[model samples]
Target: MVGLYAALELAPEDEIRLLNIPLKRQTEDIACELQVVKLRDNPKYIALSYTWGSPTSLNNEEGAEDISSKPSRLILCKAKSNSPAEPQPLWYRIMVTENLYTFLLKARDDESHALDFYWIDTICINQKDSEERTRQVNMMAAIYQSADIVHAWLGEEDKDTGMTFQLIRALASCCTGNERHKRIEGLKDITPKALGTRELTAKLGACADISNWKSMAMLFHRRYFTRAWTIQEITLAKKMLALCGSHTIDWEDIVKVSEFLTVTSWTRWISEVTGSHQANHAVPNILDANKTSGNILYSLIRSRRFMSGDPRDKVYALLGVAGDSVRGKSRLTPVYGKRSVAETYTLAAIQILEDSDDLLLLSCAEGDSFHTLPSLPSWVPDWSCSRALGLGVTGYRRYSAAATIPRTLEINESDRCLTVKGFRLDDIVSVGENKQDILSGKPFPNWLLIINAMPPIYYTGQSRFEVFWRTLITDTAGTPPCHPAPHSYRPAYVSWITSKLSACVNETAQQTGDSTFINALGALAATEIPGSPLSSNRPLSSHDNERPGDSKNSIDLDEYETTFSHARHLRLFLTSRRYLGVGSESLLEHDSIWIIPGSRVPLILREVNPSAFRVVGGAYVHGFMKGEALESNPLFRDITII
Candidate 1:
């Protein structure tokens, strides 16, 4: 007892007492029970020797209803074992609360190995409460900011003397016996104050030949990335690349990407090998083959498809083809631990094809009763093509316009629903055959959009569409809209006429003059189709005596219904946007797609592109819209085919 206090400071006037518990008793039964009993004695704080099962019992008290809910602190032991050289199994409950890590270790000098350590964070913290955890993260920087000294127990317990000497010798070949002893001396006196010199610490930690740099960086990245390495890591990795110099050819220009680095001597060493594994049926060592395969896959992602022609390319291609199988067998785990290479590739391809609007066009011939949408070329299969590209379907799939006949428009004033007079849309396609082979019963593969009464521009949020019509007398595909603002461009005048008629229809229903609606409809019909009979040659202003009931409120309904039908067919010949999912920049970036089989796949707003569709003939993706006629584009797209 006198030896224990010999080196430790003790207040001269204060009394010191020692109450050592019996070592032979089970740790949980006696030591832990005594800990609770002593804590209940109203002591300010307690330092418990965490022998064997003591940590488990103490951690259990964290959530126990019987214990005090006040902030209780425990002084944990940091000492290692005394005699046994080999690391043994141990158990101690650890808590990961806020940003503070707390753990209990046995404070014993025993050589025999009866107790084990348990390293668990959940059991140590009250994880059931989020507020408590958030409070913990906010406290981390403060608690660690002012520590005077920190210790590193590099030497294992019961190890032979001069162990650190042996470690230095094995690490560096040129080390002499004197230098080895000097290194050991350095380790013995290392302190937090000495490591406070940021420059010296970084150089010491970043010995490239040393594998332990990663471990050292891990200890510091969380704190230092926001502090020192915010500038350091980026600078260091950049310098490393510069040391290798640049190549005349870009990585994407390389053919046979796997061999381009190793077999060809066109460039210096570009990257350091982290680790490797072998591939199936590979002639090269499994480790080397795996390295090549990874390199090939990464190159393809960077759009270096031309460079990946080696045997390793075959492995990578097959990995894409048999994506799930390869993923199931691979050792790599995604950060989220769920996404696979196939899914990643599909997502990237979807991104590239959807960004450009030029790839979305197709030829369509419109007639009185039917329209035909032309087929996209081999390059235009949309999202489905990415999965089976250069294989399976050598040509694009085509879909003919599902013929629709215009019927008398019927109005129901009581309800907003408008009925297509004498026409049923049910038999538009041969259900069983088309459903099985062509349409696949997937709306994303069909080229028709059934829109409500709103103008497409108000719903799409595309600035160009809203500005197109005021300038062009002809309504061409991909033309801009009509607007008078600074950035505005005009669209076809006929579009304005149609919109005016639609507005009148809405106004008439809301108790406005029915004659106004009728006159607007007649004006639009007569202008768009010259020499057309509008059922009335006179404007509603002249027909002021006519009953408001006879004024056609249904006129706007018929116009919208016909326009929507034509737009549906036009989608088959044009590329439409499809939602890809939430983006990395979004607040809900990592939100998983809650998908059921045969249900619509949600797309991200920016990731929506026309090329994501695979249909027989032509298809496109449409940006998301509400069921109402006039609405804003939903941030995400609801994928509709065609």
Candidate 2:
């Protein structure tokens, strides 16, 4: 016990603890032994990655409840004595989560003839000693990267999991290495104009059947995908296997499919022919090809969906995989007990703000949402909260409201307030129904009404119809946004407008002035027609709206619906300054928008008092996306955000 504790403090570059699980015997409790070996000696070992606590979703797989909610059980770890005088080995009963114990049992059985050593964080690190825990934590990137094999405990298989994995393999066929080469050959001949047929609707509908569709959602809904710490573990591993009971899935297979899904839609929509699986430009943000502020901020933005018990772990776990620029600028260490989560997050925020000349982190600060940490300031992103969407959508950073301008800020650490210089961009004069409300089959005429009541789009010389379409898609298309979204998307947008209007036609029973706007929108939706010249004279007929597949534009409408997934989480707004854009769903009627210098996108802010404001999150204002509002005599004021 004495030697084991001292060895941790003296841990060197090559030193690591690997549990040696003896061959399993039936009807016996799991037991293990430890060996502190030098990696330079090339001791082959497997690393296990898992969550020690309950799922944030609280919807654990049935019968795997013990894996998440079971109380910790002791595992006997017999270690070699420090001296020969003490001939017998000393025993330590280290507490292990049931999930860890389950892995030990399975690994012992599976590897009884295959291997002997395993590396797991819980028992390996002395959780009681903060310094030892932090030291080992800092070495996680190395440990995971060095492992012979990384096994992710995704929890025991549910009834649907086997089919889910089978479905994944099937859908992933087009993205397989062989198909990648074949797709590229076909891609050269398939122009963006011809890719509309690339919807792969019939093919997608086949593999993405109703059963498989629900299974796919359930697969992702599993707790394993949502852990923040696992981000680095998954990214750095040379090879990983996601295990659910006896079922095994190659990590590469999952990624190949995910990358395919993330790319194919927007890649085909754009001029780029990136059908190859090796194209890193279309890779996940954490595994991005380049090491820059883009890697750090972009991954952080995407991580809002992942969970961590310690808020600080949200930042610390990701740092292991962040670009060198981020790790170098923010020399952050995982000090578990010294600071409050708010203080730690603020420190991380300050470093991130200073790292990127622009306020890239600003895009992550979401609107008022559910947060466990009450002390967290409004300006700082509560990474634990899913929050809502923002301008940080993939490739959205290209919208440079303060293009190339370095960020400027003065943080009053005492109160956790951030003050910055910027001009008042606009004030929200009218805000339509939120995404949830509109998508819930509620009154969409309110949206039509709000737009009808809006003042002219005098700033950009764009029409109401033009701004309406552009704002919905944040005025950009593609995964990596392509500016002035292709004209091909117009018919799709009009098609979407018609479909939503048709669903709520029954709302006419409780008709108000909004009914007239609904009638007018049907006409407005006809502004664009597929395979025909753009004009508003052709009104959309009832047949086109009701029976979707019967219309020629149905394919384009489905394309718009699929691509418009991000906008479904946002609200469309018209400002007092005559600006139009999509903003946070938490937006209100009078929220103000500001263009802070060094910030890439416009910020939606709500005033709390004369001196302070609550951040309502970032926005995608049309016309002003490219620093359009910066006048020669631009007025800059130090606005304080809580």
Candidate 3:
């Protein structure tokens, strides 16, 4: 950690670094200095957002300088000069990181770009001073928002950067309604010899060469998109420019291309033409910047993949770009060393729940059996960890359970408990271990082993297993109607399940033939037989007796196979009452399924002590998820969760 003991206090407003860009000199090297100035002064400046690469490797020596040996003070010069007759040089001592020093040198060298000042975090704030660092971090939203332009420096360019930016600009131009034909003409003019010799040009449909798409993908894959701080830097800037070495592209053009690629079937098209599934992986992060409203929880969840040196920055970095409602409710002021990581995250969860007045935040909690912070309640999500457990894949689905009863959920911080008014739905009685192969990205061959491992009750009749499987994949409530039915009356769950499964199977079969389809179906059927372990090669009666030419038999086989395939994404769990549901993979046997009043889904809670429990994860209990528990013998109790 960077530490500073000396304090240099400024006026009570947002103070930012004002870079004194050195005048052109005949010398090979020119030194640039930075000073602090209030943002209210309306300085014409550009804000830089870049990642601080990995730490410099230390030299091997008997006596090497360490953190303590480094200089404790930085010389800061004022941007403005005093009268020439009585010139008085003023300097203040502060600390600066090596990364900031390199950035300053680069900015000074780029004399073509005119700017009176610049605001960069490392140099602007006295990082050693906790109070100043906290104040500046809290005002980051305003600092970036007030800047004339935000310059996104993507580090030194590589050989392909020029071609990448050219393709990006050309694709962005194609998005303009009137410039489509013009852009097409421009692309046709520079068709690479490699593309011109092949049929790729014709296949691209007036867009840039297919090979260029690979270059564009490489550009987006830069570390710039993966940093948590850049999200707000690009989103909040009034006018932004992306700089890569000598090349530059407008931020608006990048946003336009992102929007265009997302709306068009760009990813599918790229895969079809170039046979590359990874072509558009970075497009989602670019689109995230355009999202201005809705739940901030989704943004926070999505940003977990991003890296930050300081763990607290995972939440602090996003407060600026988060919506007004979330920003107001969270009210997360950055307090550097005073609060522990557990306290920061715990407080964030409490505020979100209190503000939304719902249990949606609980849905984001994944089970942490070995809790990183023992002081933190189980219900609070450990944002520092990368494991995504609760709600599993279904958490991302856009559907909420019907609201039939009023819920009042409150947190008792002093008691370290969460008190909610709701009835216990069921207790988890059995849970199957998540397949290591599937989690490791390998195909799981035995779906039946998982099903057969469940209690016999799940395999009886139409099977509650089918209900659980149907709920996991399709958003039944969000499905469009088939005709005469009113908007409010959605299709029955069973009918919707059959239709969706048949559609998926038919589509897959159409793409790959009957041989692959039958093989997949046989594998699924082999799992349903009694006493058949996952490794058993014995073919079941269902697979052996199937008539390939029978349409009814094919549909039934497809439905079963499709359901099994979807269920592979979820872990099967049984309630103490023997009720079946799909839950987080980390769920354990004693965890309780709860239907809090405002929650759209049931949540899993694990007991910590006698009366207090912590959240294990969330669940998709088939029968009770849609407020059914509230309708049947509705009883409210003070449920204490810690």
Candidate 4:
């Protein structure tokens, strides 16, 4: 562990020397390159970290002359992937191990058989150097992907009890269905020969078939999952239901998750463990809340990008592919005759996500305070989230201008909103006004911000009169009477569809009547209260707190430690570029401010004309009381405190 810590300290700026040879050449090379010898002649410390399999082979005396040249502290040990077996190896107790990428210390020099110490990989690898870490990351896929056994080290006694054990046991139990210890204890109830056969059978199955896939899956699940996942798990469950084409789950497990949700942290592990188990099962009868949470959890596991510590491009890819499948599934509903359940859950997911947006934003906001956790782009958060751009200019070319802006707006964060001044032909023409009068004045609501941008009519060159099936299985029926229309047939369809959606969505909101959204919105407002009045909300100003050593141009781990350490201390979630923005793959720096929840950023407004005023960015205003007085700053005067 000490060596690993030293490696962490030394690896940031220097390439590690593996010290593979019989002498101390690797260590000497490392010292020479770093100029530590010149800076502090005969530097006091030399720590030796070795692999467990190679411990006996290291001849400590071979490099005595080399070691004699410097004032040194030597700590040596071999790395072990798992606990030692009988003869007790070192101390009678088992040694603890961490994830493969990093190593942890498990024993001291006083212990026999065990070397003075062992260097855990993760701690030893210089995490600060993305270039160096990249090598480790690239190898991670194989490490976890092909591993035979993955062990989790739950910390000391009382701290190890309750949730920690529950989580560990839950994961392990997912594969074995019971603790190995208990299973072994129960074995005494049976004949020894029967147990031997059982063990043999298990081993054969594990090696030949997918006997232990669940455990591997669990390990991978924990490695990638970094936060509370009740919400994500629920989301995944719903998706799995869609995958299975069902709206039901095992009754027993659903009750378990429900129970967990209502309990305190001490018992919360019940929900966390069960949630993963149930999601793995893909139960549908689960509530929208639980389903959403499950889906998010599932996404993290099945997600290659997140697990491998890469950005969310793979997430986008996965979603895009799923969207295609969803469309296909929607089309197949009529034939398979499962439209009701599929549509029900689909609508449920939409409603649930919409309802939870505030909560999600709030959770993410609080977790990500000080801009540590990267957030999903505004569009990514809600697949159905849509915004319309308003074109304000009018009468440039009435008939021709209509071609410029479509009624439907597709999802894009940076340019979702529309503006009038800079763009050509902004407004719809008045029906009765003469060409001259129509051109004379701007419309009252010059900039129309479409609250719920309706989906565009899908076109594959079909005639307008042709009846194409839509996923809105609940709405369609015999054609309702319509006014004979020569001038606006298309406009009429667009308006009708939009009105139906708008009314239905609004109706659903009134029905459920949940206030979680408002609460989440309040949370979001808390984060922005700190920075709003100090400066303008421009994209560039986001990373104001980042130091000079850390910039967009370079990847530095010290910056990461500084930033995440602060975030972890503050109990806020920290994220990086993967959650937002485009460019290089790196975590978001401290100075990089994510003041507003991306989902709430309203894309259409961002595209407002570059000429009149560009909303470079924005934030919520809250925390302070409306009339409370405060010392004057550059942005506001007589600010009130909450």
Candidate 5:
């Protein structure tokens, strides 16, 4: 055993102990030793980030014991008396994981790497002490940041582990300076087919190789990426090194490769080329680490896939990286064992909303009709529920008039209820079942059938009626048609639905040999005379002659096929006033549509009581979209929801 020196003194309150790596391996009963020190002493050390391998597997290994069942005990170290006049040696006992012990022993024995002290959670913190564990977990961000270097241990290396690190290093080296910038830009513009081309393949080096891509993808599949604490551990480190058995790689190289692989269209290309056999689940999170900053709410929501033994730690573990303003507003003090997981999550939601002063968090809410956890309020998203659906609408214009609404949200902490001041736009008179498509397995059925199912609206003539279905299906459902310059600047909903459809149909007809579909579209356009009373009042042009099968024009069958395929997921619902809506397949009868204050799209709400409702999810109601509801004469009221 190493002798304890009495030259240094530590404060009684500073109970953190650092594991000291012996100079050489020992044949004694205790293979390693620990040195008790104060964190206030500013000791230089390395922090470890790793996943606790399954206890069953670990316990079965030689020299491994089930420490989880053992009670924690304190070791007392008596310093050797100076000149034989002082007392004997001090003794202390600390509990640590078998894997950590193995890592420390290896680091100590390796001549190339000399390690003195380490801050590992399992050994440093007294896990049996709830208060101490809470305090230590809360300080993880600082501990990792304060370390000289953070080491990520990805278990013992396998046959392909060295290949994974080598591949990442090669990729990082290739993507640098002026050449790298051009490659990234060129990759952005490259089509899916071009990914496998000789020119592109040579530029990306081994990364373009299907075998290397599979190995790299499998590397990320390691369990270290799925642990909740590892997010902050890697993010807060000033410098980090990833260790896989004997192989090592810089953390920045791993991050760079991850970012490169996550480019918008590249994921699909890689997944397809690789046959989707490799695990790419953790790639998104590695990318998110570089993008998300200081927004703890965003981090928490994004990290829902991460696993934690204690549910409360999901929120508590993230407090270290949360911004100062968010922390102040949330005022979450770590008190393990004092509150239930439900209470902790509910508190986090309330505090986040109060701090952000926006309802963007509500966008993460799960549909009440789908999966509901017992005892959880509908408004408070259950972070533990991994199956929550994503926000229905995208491309939210942040500066839009509807987004600027001044609404105050209040939380009833005791009852776990939410209150907000907003108007009731319309009551849901009827809701259609989720339409299913046989081809794509999506909920969106035929757009024409959806619109016709609604009550008849006033029209100038039968020709005008035919035009409505054609425009709404081909334009609103498929892709909005394109129009002349001045008309293109109209309200987003109107301009979007109108211009894209016309352009898609024209382009689709001019590129494909599907004369049957083109003739049907042309006949519908011809039925409506030039001077008909259309919503936009724009006359149908003479371009009907350019339909598919026209000798002079070429039709794009790809776009034509894509339009029908994409439109299959949308289902239409009608309110009592005949207001039309397009939303998810989960929509049920009597579900109300509401344009909540800060949300980008109107949400579907299910009535729980006379006036109280639970959030079903967000939706795209045709006329009510694009802030139109805010200008309408609806009775605004303060409503309480759970």
Candidate 6:
């Protein structure tokens, strides 16, 4: 660390450094040689894809290098001495995290992996030199894509790893091999709803093992899947295989299983088994990620951070995979020290809006109005926080709130406000419980309270009670996940709600592996609210006698819960005009909903002053979703949101 080393300066713009592993090394000697390679020469090497774990804090008793992990071991790096005139090769002792050290040891002993040279970010990149870091980051995509093999280290295996890996192989096989599954897979929208009641139950059973659902859930519990950098690292890799201790699994199999779980909504059951909301959440993120083809918006949505302590990385980390982020094309150039996080986030929001040519990014700002960075404008999203967009905003569902009119959207970076032209749709008068209530079957009462306050008739004179079920699912249903609601959902909704009101959640959840429904509906039977409609006096619907084990009833609960779970952490709201909708958990009583032009769904905006405002988040209002509020000669105001 002293005069023994200078810097790992990658002198040439096109040249890079690699850690050279000697074929035979002294067991006691930890020194590894360094090799410089030119991209033109096309050398063979493997890169590492992993998450930088929690750092050791100042209060940590370990007293070790605290950047990525707690325990770090000394590694000798071959470097040049400080003297320029007579540069001598010196063995410099450096520290690598215990995790990385273990990975290196595994790589060394791995007879299957024969590449001698390796490219690891922490050792290969000059982190202390900001200029060099920027240069290297620009080449990260090319580095991963050009690598002969990219080995993803999923950290040392745990007790569940064996069972999870076995389940992963089985589920991955079922997705591709099972003939019964293949019939449903052949349909354009391969969802559980696409199958008949018998097929749905049979399909759930036909998988190699549904009993190992907990193990499958534990696989996603790995921190490696949540890091922002993992998206680009695994996405751009030419050939990738995940390594966990002694076991190695193809990355494609993991992707296939995750995507399969997503379409079928089987991932929701993981929450019941693992009792971890994180595992419940992670599988769908894999659904959002496409291996080789994805756009900037999709890349941004999938890049959830693992708190690397740098907010700017939430945007910078995904630049490599953002199709629009090519050098000259993207306004989002990855700058290190030049800009603040506020400036970076503002710049990124502007860049994405202009590049994406829509207001979709505005919908992604899901945190509470309390801006993490005080300087960050309300219109500018704090990418540091991870949040999912509204269900209506997903590619699977289509809703055009503004007709075919060209957008009059403008970004006023000088004042940090977005000027958009559209009419105010409604004001959120009452807000209900969010997705968290579903696990306890308690969301029903407060949501029912909000819906009950409104008139029985909808704006179009349709039954508000009927529309309530449609609004719960954003009015999209069918055999496919994204189809229009068939007449069946109405009766199905009756059966779904009555089943919850009549039955006991603890007993039913154990029988059906459905704690979420019990959580949502259990409150009605369990709690006695004074004016709650479904209190003791109200008779259970016609389906009360049908047990959850009944095939017909089980299929309906599966379909409804599966559909509702996809849109997580949303709160039901009643607008001032009696319109019902589900919005971001951040939605409040006084927040106004606006139908901004060129936006697929309406957005919640909190007024800061008279005309200026702050974007709350996206919403799925019942009546105005399909441009019903847009009149031919409707006046559009230029509202500015800071």
What is the per-residue lDDT of model 5 for residues 321-347, given as tens digits with 9 covering 90 to 100?
Answer: 774644444347677777877777777
TM-score of each: 0.18, 0.81, 0.70, 0.24, 0.69, 0.82
lDDT of 2 by residue, 324-350 (tens): 655444336677888877777778887
- Over 4 Å off in model 5, which ranges? 1-15, 28-30, 54-102, 174-183, 186-197, 204-207, 269-292, 326-331, 369-372, 387-389, 392-401, 425-587, 620-625
lDDT of 1 by residue, 101-164 (tens): 1222222223221232221212221344344332322322221221111111111222221222
Task: Mark the regions of model 2 whose C-alpha exceeds 4 Å error after superposition.
Answer: 1-14, 40-42, 53-70, 80-86, 111-114, 176-213, 262-294, 323-331, 370-372, 392-395, 455-459, 508-555, 608-612, 631-633
Q: Each candidate: how many clashes?
A: 59, 1, 4, 54, 28, 6
Give the per-residue Cα lDDT of candidate 4 at 236: 25
Q: Return whichever of 1 and 5 wins on lDDT.
A: 5
Order by TM-score, highest first = 6, 2, 3, 5, 4, 1
Q: Top model by lDDT, which number?
A: 6
Task: Please give, for residues 583-639, the per-residue lDDT of candidate 3 as tens digits.
Answer: 666687787887777667777777666556777766776555555565567676777
Clashing pairs in 6: 439-519, 440-519, 441-519, 441-520, 441-521, 442-519
RMSD of 6: 7.1
Quickly count the clashes in candidate 3: 4
TM-score of 1: 0.18
lDDT for model 3, please.
Answer: 0.55
- Write candidate 4's Cα lDDT for 293-326 as tens digits: 3233123222211211122222222232232233
lDDT of 1: 0.22
Residue 315 lDDT, candidate 4, scale 0-100: 29
On a 0 to 100 scale, what is the lDDT of residue 9 in model 2? 45
State the C-alpha lDDT per candidate. 0.22, 0.64, 0.55, 0.23, 0.54, 0.65
Model 6 ranges with Cα > 4 A deviation? 1-8, 54-71, 79-88, 177-211, 279-288, 291-294, 305-307, 324-326, 329-331, 367-370, 395-397, 477-480, 486-492, 499-554
The residue pairs in collision within model 2 are 357-407
